[model samples]
Every structure is written in C-alpha cells, then in structure tokens.
Target: MLINKSFANQAGVSLIEILVTTLILGVGLLGVAALQISSLSSNQEGLFASQATAIAEDYASRVRSSKTSTVMPNTNISYAQFVAAYHNGNNAPLACAAAPAQLCRSDAGNAALDCTLAQLAIYDQWEVCSAAQEALPGGLVRVLNNGIRLTIVVDWDSEQGREDIGNVAVRNNNCSPLTGSNTRNCVILELVP
Candidate 1:
C-alpha cells in the first residue's frame, strides 16, 4: 500500500509548532502568577488598614468614656487636661510604675501602685501606641488636638511604594506624617467631644 506523501508530512504537529505552543502556555502561566502576587499584596494592605481603624476606634472610645465627668475626682484638672495627656508624638512609652500613685486601680499585681486620671490617660496612649507598633511595619502613632477635635494618626511602612487606588493620591500633605514618604500609609481618625 502506498501512503500519500502530503498526508504523511502533515500527520502530526511539527517541532516548531510544539515549541510555540509551550512558549504561549508559559507566558500565560506567568501572567497568572503576576496577578496572584498583586492580589496578595492588596489583601495585606487592606488588613493593615483595618487594624489601624480598629486601633483608632479603641482609643477614641477610651477618650469618650473619660469625658463622662467634667473633672477628675479629688482634682481640679478637667477632661480636657486628661485628653491632652494623649497628645504624644512618637514618644517612648510612659513608665507606669514610675508615675505617682493615686486612686485609679490597675491590675492584680500593681493594685497598690494605682494611677491618677492623667497617668491613666498616658498609660492608655502607651498601650495604643505599642499595639500600632507591633501590628504594623515601622508603625507610629500621633495624637493631635486642634482645640475642638481630637485626631488619631496611625502610620506604617507599606514596603512597596504608594498604591494609588481609584486614581486618588494616597500621599497628601494634609496627612502630616504620611506626607514624608511615598512608602508610608496612614489612617487618620478625628473625634469631637
């Protein structure tokens, strides 16, 4: 039986066709991998923002609770004074143990070494700042007051440069600490008492 020459030559895919097919598949896989990486980075950024929001909320609640009484018991110092104690900027945590003892009771071990209302405010700031630093990369906290309002600014390093979402600029001069670095992200929350 004689095989048709043309049919035999075209029976299977050529070597060049196989190589081209493999190259296309490899490029497609690489694109998928790039997309996966971008997705993971975005997820991480969202998580950090969520954490910052929660931290700011927690501190705001504490401040609100303190505003219940106009003046601290047994002291002329007012609620505004208490709020002012939290206006710290990247300062080292206050030494709670070194602070003067007062009526404000703490935990079991340090029940005797109680804190004053002002001391309590400082301690609260320290706790919030520590939380921010631990939960984020290069984290920092700034408590700012402009007489009528209180602002909590939580800053962290994004590793990669700024990510502009929805064509909105992430780095704004109004953000204070965030304006310095393109790689830094911040959550600013304002509370009015």
Candidate 2:
C-alpha cells in the first residue's frame, strides 16, 4: 500500500478564493459601467452645444443677408427687430413644411410669394427660436444689442450626472459660469451684422 497525502490536501479550488475573485470582478464591472455613464452624459452635452451653435449661426446668416431696411420707417426690417421678435414672448404657432418653418410656403422651386421684409424678419426669428426649442431640451433664446455688437444667447437644461447626484439649483444670473448648484448650460455667439 502507498500513501498519497499531498494529492488529497490539494483541492481543485477553495471557496474563499472563488468568492474573492467574484468580488474583484464585480468591482471592476461597476467601474466600467460608471465610465460608460459619464461618457454618455458628456456626449449629450456636446450635442446640445452643437445644436445651439448651429441655430445661432443660422439666424446670424439670415440677418446678414437681409441687412438692408427695404420697408418704411414703421415697418423697417433690421436684425434688431428680428432679435426683438424672438424675445417678445409671443408664442405664435408656426405652420410650414420646413424644419425651421418658413413664413410662406414656396411653390416647388419658385421663390416665396408675397413675402415682405417685415414678414421675413419675423419669420427668421420665429424659425430660429422654433428650431432651437425643438432641438434642445428646455431651450430659451435671448438677444442683446450693444450698439455695434449683437450677442445671441441660447440656454438649455441638462440631466447629465443629475440622476446620480440629485436636483441641481440653476441660477439666472445672466449666463455666468455654473457652479455645483447650477445645472443649466448656455451658449453665447456674438456677431456684428
């Protein structure tokens, strides 16, 4: 007869070792999940910023194209008027086939019929605000005129990291830097058109 004590002592795997391995793997997986969540939040913020920029540029370009005041003194169309139209707090519903919603429907390839300069100004502002609000969550548009300069401000709310942290206190201090209490984001574009 032969004695094999070493072979009997060596088991396949200990219960403590398996549990420790599982705990380490779980912790690693949790870290990966947290990273994924953070990446998504950052991506969403970038998306909102891009949308705001595009909206601002669209209005700026349109205003530049129609800089001349072709109408009379009472109906003179200017960028200032367009900006005011946006901030006037008038929520007139827009009905058009385009994304920005044109003032009048163009027939096929022909130009828009019976569209006046004043109408164009109002339409430009309406379209800009509509597109901005539709694209960004809790969107608000503001225009500031400083003699020779114009600043277009777009504000929107974000839920990034809010789910984990809690409710954030957003301040309306003219779009300044957001602290731990602030959750909203603002995009500012200044143009002299």
Residue by residue across 1-193, what tens digits does model 1's lDDT show?
9999889878688899999999999999999988986776677778888998998898898777666543445477755676676665343322333433343436467563445567667666666777877787767676777777877777777763234322222454555443366656788899885
**Error in Å for residue 168 of model 2:** 6.8
Full-model lDDT, candidate 1: 0.67
Model 1, C-alpha of 5: deviation from truth (Å) = 7.3
> Which pairs of residues collide in candidate 2?
none
Candidate 2, residues 1-193, lDDT tens digits: the string is: 7869988779788899999999999999999988997676667677878998898888778767656444234464555565554333332222323443444335468577455555676667667778877888766666666556667777677654244534332444656542122566767788877
Clashes of each: 0, 0
Which stretches of candidate 2 lie above 4 Å from their native place? 1-8, 68-111, 114-116, 160-174, 177-181
Top candidate (lDDT): 1
In candidate 1, which residue ranges exceed 4 Å CA deviation? 1-8, 69-75, 89-114, 160-179
Candidate RMSDs in Å, in order, are 5.5, 6.1
